[model samples]
Target: MTANREIDSILQRAADGGRITPEEALLLYTEAPFHALGEAADTVRRRRHPDGIVTYLIDRNINYTNVCVTACKFCAFFRAPKHKEGWSHPMEEILNRCGEAVDLGATQVMLQGGHHPDYGVEYYENLFSSVKQAYPQLAIHSIGPSEILHMAKVSGVSIEDAVLRIKAAGLDSIAGAGAEMLPDRPRKAIAPLKESGARWLEVMAVAHRNGLSSTATMMMGTGETHEERIEHIRMIRDVQDLAVERGYRDDAVETGQEIGGFRAFIPWTYQPENNHLKGRTQATTMEYLRFLAMSRLFFDNVSHLQASWLTTGKDVGQLSLHLGVDDLGSIMLEENVISSAGARHRSNLHELIWMIRTADRIPAQRDTLYKHLAVHYTPEDDPTDERVVSHFSSIAMPGGGAGRKQLPVVGVS
Candidate 1:
């Protein structure tokens, strides 16, 4: 069949509650009309989130260490093991950041960092225990499959054991980082030292089997083809389906819906600044919208589709709401890793309210667990007296202000 015919059929299947094969998905991604694609995806979004209101989370990302062993070429943040400026966040510093997040009304803290050589599961256990002890209200969402692989190897433990130990110490969920690319070719090109695609899925599968459902993410526009993009979605959907099947088998009394599955799927464009893939143009707004809409259509079982304003900018992020995204990721009281990679868009609480209202949707502040805390409708501008916060470099604190910023607290872009 022609690409157009294939896409139309696939879209019809999705609209009619039937699943499309991976090849059909690929064709739809390549040839589906933009308006039709958006409508189809929006239908799915409406089904999942019947309410017209979309949601965002109040959270912060705290990078625990910059010293990395798996130095990917696409990364601009990781420091070599022997680099003079290499460092890790001290326990006190981590605890302080969590406190700051809690003070700002953030209930989630993502403790992402490089794969440090010396750290073990014990390190995470102690850090998680301390964070939980300090702020029991905060959900400790940290680490990805890649970091898990490194930790498992370094600590001489199975992924299952590592997850159980971390959970015991209060790690709530995995962050799904290190997913630069899903296919082996692109994965090898960017982060060869990281675990293979299968291995990454294996670890996440273990986590899901152990009753911890986590979000999945895709990093796109890194010299991959449209077909490859569909494959990435297919891979995640396959895993999600497997997770559902596994859950049913694990418990005799528990129904599939009672067990944890893939909670959300987020796709963000690649940041092509100050990295080995320099000079390569990042994905365009149209491309991002296309991918976002396509992901919503293809991954029908995934609960939420997140718009990545942090990487795509405010206008594109807002536009994404119409293109079938049901959530705008987080407020991120603190976000450095992506900012360092050239995401210049900024937002405060006032701006976030204005954006959401202007788009004809209700803005809600939520916790990491998707529990709604507040629905914001006020359209007031930020107070002029609000102090400006620095962005790591200008932060003046203990440890001589190294890599600390003093940026203003704000909502997500």
Candidate 2:
């Protein structure tokens, strides 16, 4: 354990807006008092967001295909190409899900899937163009460095060229879906077929340079050491520093306009169930909150930190609002990736607003760019839209019938 005075000194410096080093973060993550770490993180959160408003997004996850070539052992969502079980969502079904998202008041759609050997840039271009032509209102915040690299390799184009092509084809931004862990040891173990950590960061920088901002993510409890976890955050922060230096992002974004870098940092625990990991290791609730708080202190350059209710339970997600998180992520109207890996938590619109209000903060609906579109002030005024709910359907379901059009009721009593 760290000396009491030393930990206090570190927390005080961090809470006072002084940047803490990787060594200090490691000390706090492994040895500091749990509640004290949370308190320091809460102080920083309040300083950043003085308003008592917590934000959420009305979005859906649409996986176009499950046929993949880059087999990551940690993922239960992907099926090998040409396997009888592997299936791609027909274009009609993809568009139908978008129509459902529009009816449910979704502002963003996350399109990610397996790296099918047959899918090239043309496939994504056609998919994104069709989504845009049908629903121009929805921001196509889809895919990440992994998919980009796969598509580029298939099309024999450079990564930069691929990003630009997709942007023109209607991709507004990229999600942090594929960023499981950014360090070498853990990432290589989980995704040996995937790119290296440096290559992943290089692709994100490529996107930023092309004016497509994205969110950063880290998946904890994948057999990563405590020191390796800090390394992930440090790598992302270093890239953010480069973005600020190159004028891709401002030093401080007081206004809502974005200049194209990582807008938020979301760290979620790895769910090990049917996957190859087999639940041998997972992050406990205590570790998650500590790391969440530590991330808030470390990501001084990133703007938002989102709470992952779907992976962690709702109670912990709510507690995160006090610790460091300013956002509760999406209601995730339809999610199959993590669900396929044994993550079972789910929520709806009413529950989300109530979760925020009960935490003594107002709940606001934000767009993909972190711009507030609507804010719920009183319980009497919360939208009674039953359509904004998740079915908690996993990709491992019997078939591709996840009930997209059905509006499930969330009981308040």
Candidate 3:
């Protein structure tokens, strides 16, 4: 058959809820009409989430340390272990930030940082336990597979033991940080000191086997090829398939526990400013959108696809709703890592709800587990909570907490 006919057939199969091969996904990503691809992805989104609600979370990303042993080339956020600026937040300081986040109505705190050489699993265990002891209501969605591997190595424990210890110490879930590119060539190019892509997946698998659910993320625009991008999703899908085969979902259903395996997939572009990679090549906005649509169409087992409005501006983020994204990510009370890498986009509780509403979807505040805690169906019924401001920590701004503005509620463009 001709290329046009083959592409059309693949699009139809994907739109009709049939799984497409990786090659088909790459073809769709490369050749499909932008609008057609988006429409098919939107169909999939609506079919998966019939509620017509776009979900978001109120969370704070607290970087506990800037000291890193693995100085990834693409990251502008880390400091060498012996650098003068390298510092770790004390336990009291971390608890204070958590207190501030809780006061600002954040339901989750994403605790991530560089791989500190001296810090082992015990550091995390104490931190997580203290946070949970003080704020039992707050969800501790912290760390990633890379951190697990690093800590496991530092503490001389197996990955399974490290994950189990932290989970028992009150780590609610893991974040998909450090998954810059899962393909070997691109991953080695960016994060040479980090664990291998296969090892990352292995650690995540161990976490899943131990009943910890986590989200997955991709950092695009780091000079990876189109084929490598598709390969990343394929790797995730293969692992997810194994989780299903192992009765992870069945165990959740039978025991009333939260489902094991990845809960969502979030893909964002790599910010190139102030980083060693230095913007030699980056994924364009169009490229980012295409990848987003392709991810929604391809990751059939993953239930949620979040738009990274924090990296992609609010305008594209608003447009992403129609292009197959069901979640707008988070109204981050504090974000240092991405902002340090020159991600300037910002949003508050009011602005996020308005953005989703203008996209012609109901806005809902979601917990870390993707559970809708509150849904705003109408503008008149929107929450009037003033503490829900954007950049509350203001770590990205100089002198901290200055120049933060109240975002006006505007109509959809």
lDDT against the true structure, per candidate, is 0.75, 0.86, 0.86
Candidate 3 Cα deviation (angstroms), residue 169: 0.2
Pairs that collide in candidate 1 are: 389-406, 389-407, 389-408, 390-405, 390-406, 390-407, 391-405, 391-406, 392-404, 392-405
Q: Which stretches of model 1 miss by more than 4 angstroms?
A: 1-6, 248-259, 377-413
Which pairs in model 3 have colliding backbones?
none
- Location of the lowest summed lDDT over 10 successive residues in candidate 3: 402-411
lDDT of 1 by residue, 317-402 (tens): 88888877878887666667766666666665556656777888877776665656777655442223232132332121222133
Candidate 3 lDDT (Cα, 0 to 1): 0.86
Question: Per-residue CA lDDT of candidate 2, range 1-413, in tens?
Answer: 23599999999888888889999999999989988898998888898888878999998898898899988888988889789889898999999888888888999999989999988899999999999999999999999899999999999999999999999999998888788888888988999999988899999999998888889999988889999999999999999988877777632245544458899999999999778888788899889999999988888888789988888888889999988899999987788888888777767888889989999998999998877898888887688887677643334433324664444443433
Q: Count backbone overlaps in model 2.
A: 0
- For model 2, state the Cα shift of residue 152 in Å: 0.6
User: How much lDDT does candidate 1 score?
Assistant: 0.75
Candidate 2: where are CA atoms >4 Å away?
1-3, 250-258, 392-400, 404-413
lDDT of 1 at 270: 84
Q: CA RMSD for every model?
A: 4.3, 2.4, 2.4
